[model samples]
Target: MRVEIDGISKSYVDSAGAPLHVVGGLTASIEQGEFVCIIGPSGCGKSTLLGMLGGLLPPDAGTIRFSGDRTATGEMTSIVWQDYALIPWRSIIDNVAFGLEVRGVGKQERKAIAQGYLETMGIGAFANAQPKQLSGGMRQRAGIARALASDPEVLLMDEPFAAVDAQTRTLLQEELLTVWENHRKTVIFITHGIEEALLLADRVLVLSGRPTKVVEDLKVPFARPRTADIAQTPEFGELKQHLWERLRDATRAAEWAEVEGANS
Candidate 1:
């Protein structure tokens, strides 16, 4: 579903009881079935924005409009968080079916449906295994499977692959792309990796430091079924360099501001 974020803003009170702005008048449009990645310096409220989009948190100001009334917070959107958030005590299959269970789906039906997603994620064999028994990458696959089981109109992923190792991260990226191609789900992915953004996103939205707003909204022109070799292309390298510089500069500026605040 298409999502339009209009004049959205948020802030929180710091330890010193001063209001600290996180996002400011951030507006963007994500078309139906579009894969959009938001990149910015650390602590710039990227995750916070994702939370608002998912309807887990409300914006302090402004509105999030979804075409056809599919607000991000409803069943139209599901989020796969960085921590996986799977139940350690439950079997993988049960965890994957948890949402269905909450929706009052029959046991047989939920398990059957959950298994379908597990097989899709290539984790069917681990269906009965406890989460702790699986490797980090495998656990993340299970997490994605669980999200897919919910069959959301849009997937809001907050650093979903950030916990995995490099090789595993690349593999997950490829697998995710394959799934996206097949299902064509609207995706809003938040990340710190410039190359990761370029490799997976149809468009990349760059944000500045705290009180963050979009600094750049770049469309990636690379052909789909993207592979590792795509990263080696000169055009890919140039875009990556440009995004890196933007993020680096924002980070440095935030650091200087923090130092000055401390001295004052």
Candidate 2:
């Protein structure tokens, strides 16, 4: 599905009872089956944007429109949070099948579907284990399996691998790419890592400081089936440097603004 976000804005009242705007007139277009990564300085409202996209939070202004067939009868979008967000009390398989069960799929059918996704994620053997029994990386794989089993048209991921170890993160990234290649779901991923964005995204959207907006929309030139070897290439280094510079400038500006606001 293609997603069109136009002039979307969101705000909350701060402790001082003043309106704290996080996103202001943000507009962007995500094409069908496109893997788009969003990156920006800290507190730039990336998660807030993802929340709105996932229908967990509503925009204060403007519209977010999806065009094309709803992929499944379940939900239009599913989110994989940074913390995994799996149920500790449920078995891994049960957690994976939770969404399907909610949609009233028969028990056997949902279990089969959940098992398939767990096997795809390389954690099928852990299907009967409780979530707390697994490692962080394994838990995240289960979380992803749960999201995929729902068969959403659009997937919103908020730094899903951020909590994993470096080695585990790399493995998960490769696995996620393989899954994306096979499923071709529209993905909007938010991350603070520029290299992660370049490695996974067809395009990267850079946002400005608070009351954020897309400041730069860069098309990644790398080819699909991306591997760690790509990072060793001079072109990859150049792109990384460029993204770092952009992020650094944005961060500096955000810090300055915070100082100014405090002084005011």
Candidate 3:
């Protein structure tokens, strides 16, 4: 599915009742089946944008539209949160089947569908385990399996691998790519790691500080079926440096803006 975000803005009031603008007329278009990664300085409202895209939050202004075939009868979009929002009381397989259940899928059918995704994520063996019994990475795998089982047209991920160990994060990235290759879901991933963005995305959208907007949209040049070894390449290093410079500048500008606002 192709997503068009135009002039979308959102704001909230601070404790002092002062208005805090988080997204300011942010506009960007994501093409069908495109893996787009969003990155920005802290407080840039990346998650807020994702929330609006998923219909969890409303934009104060502007529109978000979807143009494409509705292949799935279930929800149009599913989100994989950073914390792996799973039910502690449910078994891993049950957790994965939750979305399907919510959609009114029959018990045996939902379990079958959920099992397929669990096997795809390489965690089928943990089907009966509770969320608390699994490691951070394992829980995240279950979370992703649950999202995929719903067969959403678009997947919104908010730093889904951020809580896992470095080695586990690398493994999960590769696993996600493999699944994405087969399923071709339109993905909008938000992350603070520039390298993670480069590694996973077909294009990276870099946002400005608070009241954020897309400041830069960069295409990743590496061929698909990517691995962590690509990070050793010179092109990857150069692109990483470029993103670092841009992110540093945005962070500094935000800091200055905060100082000015405090004084004013």
Candidate 4:
């Protein structure tokens, strides 16, 4: 395993001095190269949990470990953002190589590394293009390339396709699977889209309400290389319905919490 969250919890004091818990004793294990998706209601602190996994935020209790890779803290993660987080002034190749450059990788070597990633993403044609020059999907590919270029043991993605159009989103989904198939990099992807989660994940983690914790961890038994056609299958429908039912409970719980908090 590359990632483990052992009874992890996060809590903070509200402005009024009341205790606020974001995550509650959540636990999960992710094998190296496995793609896992965390899904839950809007305010359930799924993002907060992801932040913990990346070592960007410290949990108030329990632990998140990147086994054998780092001591005391997880050091396996590299994050990809929804907005594609590329510099506007940087060329496509430059943006992809940014991490390597930061690590003091020489120009010739970093450019070669960037070129390989761009070709893999099928965006080599746009190497000289700036961020503004590419389409939304292309820019996202650049971001993925940037993440992959770092060669991290784990990849964390936050709604990476949400910024693109539906068509582009579909294409990215296909491209993402291709990347995963080829590289087998351990990926912890977070998404609000249930279908996207089901399509990409080996396992789907459903979280409940505020003080979010794992409500369900459903395995996806479907075969890989998922296309839009796969979405039309009966098995896909069954999986989708199952996920919806799980999330429905979480949504209701979140709403009730809001109502109760207001009443109090």
Off by over 4 Å in 2: 68-74
Q: List the residue pairs that clash in candidate 2.
A: none
Off by over 4 Å in 4: 13-17, 68-75
Clashing pairs in 1: none
Q: What's the true lDDT of residue 128 in model 1?
A: 99
Give me candidate 3's TM-score against the actual structure: 0.97
Model 3, residue pairs in steric clash: none
Write down the lDDT that model 2 would get. 0.93
State in Å the error of residue 36, model 4: 0.8
Q: For residues 1-264, write the lDDT of model 3, one tens digit per residue.
A: 999898999999999999999999999989999999999999889999999999889899988888833222239999999999999899999999999898899999999999999999999999999998999999999999999999988999999999999999999999999999999999999999999999999999999999999999998999988999999999999999999999999999999999999999
Better model by TM-score: candidate 1 vs candidate 3:
3
**Predicted structure 2, TM vs. truth:** 0.97
Q: Residue 217 in candidate 2 has what lDDT? A: 95
How many Å off is the CA of 173 in candidate 2? 0.3
Q: Put down candidate 1 lDDT per residue, 69-136, tens digits, no spaces.
A: 55565577888989889999999999999999999999999999999999999999999999999999
TM-score for each prediction?
0.96, 0.97, 0.97, 0.94
